[model samples]
Target: MVFGANSIAFFMFAGVVARLLIMWPIGETSLKTWLFVHVFRPLFGSLNGSLLFALSFLVLSYIFMYWLYRKRIFWKV
Candidate 1:
């Protein structure tokens, strides 16, 4: 499996880190809201903005993963 345990764990850890540092912080903008305000709201309307943002984020994540794979930078257990 190209996407093995490390990949899953990396994403989970990233989510935790994002929440801890960015999303969950007091008086700060969460990633989703920032995307909506800056990128999605302008290109797509409010109704579809959130969904498109999520899809775009997923695509970008996969692209980053592929880049890391090409660089042989897989996280170890």
Candidate 2:
């Protein structure tokens, strides 16, 4: 479980860096729009123009972890 969580965190951090690289060069307005369309619309139906993909990913990951814990299933080594 610990190792799984660590790997998840590491990959998530790397994803954040990648998102920044993609979003930053295009400017804030474009980034915000892209995030809303790509990340928010798919999951929630409503647009989340304010939150970026990294932040949304973190929130979703936490929710998923909680669900997994409730089910008493952890990734085995």
Candidate 3:
């Protein structure tokens, strides 16, 4: 079934909350390290790659969730 706008909004809200919970334990420096080791260092090879990777992932995740929302694939619960 197709979801209403409010449903999609709530799904986005839940996603943000879940993301925060997941990141809370990782901490800032570790997060940067993780990003650098797995993603940034290989692709961009810049000291600032972690920051760029984080920003890009943020934008990409939003776009991905929006695409899923358009497909009526987001969780309702």
Candidate 4:
């Protein structure tokens, strides 16, 4: 179920909530803009740009998955 959360309905929920909670306050001019920009821009503020910040997080998730696999670990529940 690792990828189950990314189905269309889930993204719709996330999109709406992200627009309200994040994009609204950050002075984003439009919801047509990417949602991750609002959610990640602050934490990644010093990363120079969204692409680098996103790539860094992607790498981090992959490393974490590999580490877990090496330990024969996976999530349950």
Candidate 5:
């Protein structure tokens, strides 16, 4: 579970980095631009949303894993 969580986190970070790099050249670098860049700019904003979703999933998965471990529970199919 730790490995899975770490892998998800790694991918999320990588995606965010790639997005920032892509936007760097065209970025306005202003406060208003920064805010607008996310919503008004589709490509820039989609990646941000993806990263946020992945991070939230990773956190929830880790919490569930910890809970299962503490309860000494395991699932079998």
Candidate 6:
């Protein structure tokens, strides 16, 4: 039972990471528009209208989820 629950959580995390990767390489403008304006802008100093090889959502999501995984964090309903 414990193994099953762990496996489900593992796969759920994998799926979320995969979805993020598939939707990556988002435009700078799109990020600015969709995400919070003050969040990353202050932290990263903006994308400067970069297009090619820009900061991707996939990379960010993987970093975030990997950190959570390392911390043994999980969300339950």
Which candidate should be chosen as best, given lDDT against the real structure?
A: 1
Q: By the lDDT metric, which is better: model 1 or model 3? A: 1
TM-score to native of every candidate shown: 0.58, 0.38, 0.38, 0.37, 0.39, 0.33
In the range 1-77, model 1's lDDT, one tens digit per residue, is: 43552486458655764565455533467665765787888889887887897677667666666667777777875
Q: What lDDT would each prediction earn against the true structure?
A: 0.66, 0.59, 0.62, 0.50, 0.54, 0.51
The sequence of per-residue lDDT tens digits that candidate 3 reaches over residues 12-46 is 75577546645654555455456667778788777
Q: What ordering of candidates by TM-score runs from best to worst?
A: 1, 5, 3, 2, 4, 6
Which regions of candidate 2 deviate over 4 angstroms? 1-33, 36-51
Q: Look at candidate 5 and give me any clashing residue pairs.
A: none
Question: Model 4 has how many clashing residue pairs?
Answer: 0
| Residue-by-residue lDDT tens digits, candidate 2, 10-76 | 4665577556746664454556557666767777666343354557656766666666666765654
Measured with C-alpha atoms, the lDDT of residue 44 in candidate 1 is 90
Position 56, candidate 5: lDDT: 53
User: Which stretches of model 3 miss by more than 4 angstroms?
Assistant: 1-47
Q: Indicate the TM-score of model 5.
A: 0.39
Model 2: residue 56 alpha-carbon error in angstroms: 1.1
RMSD of 3: 6.1
Displacement of the residue 40 alpha carbon in candidate 1, Å: 1.0
Clashing pairs in 3: none
True lDDT of residue 36, candidate 4: 51
> Worst ten-residue run, lDDT, model 4?
1-10
lDDT-superior candidate, 1 or 4: 1
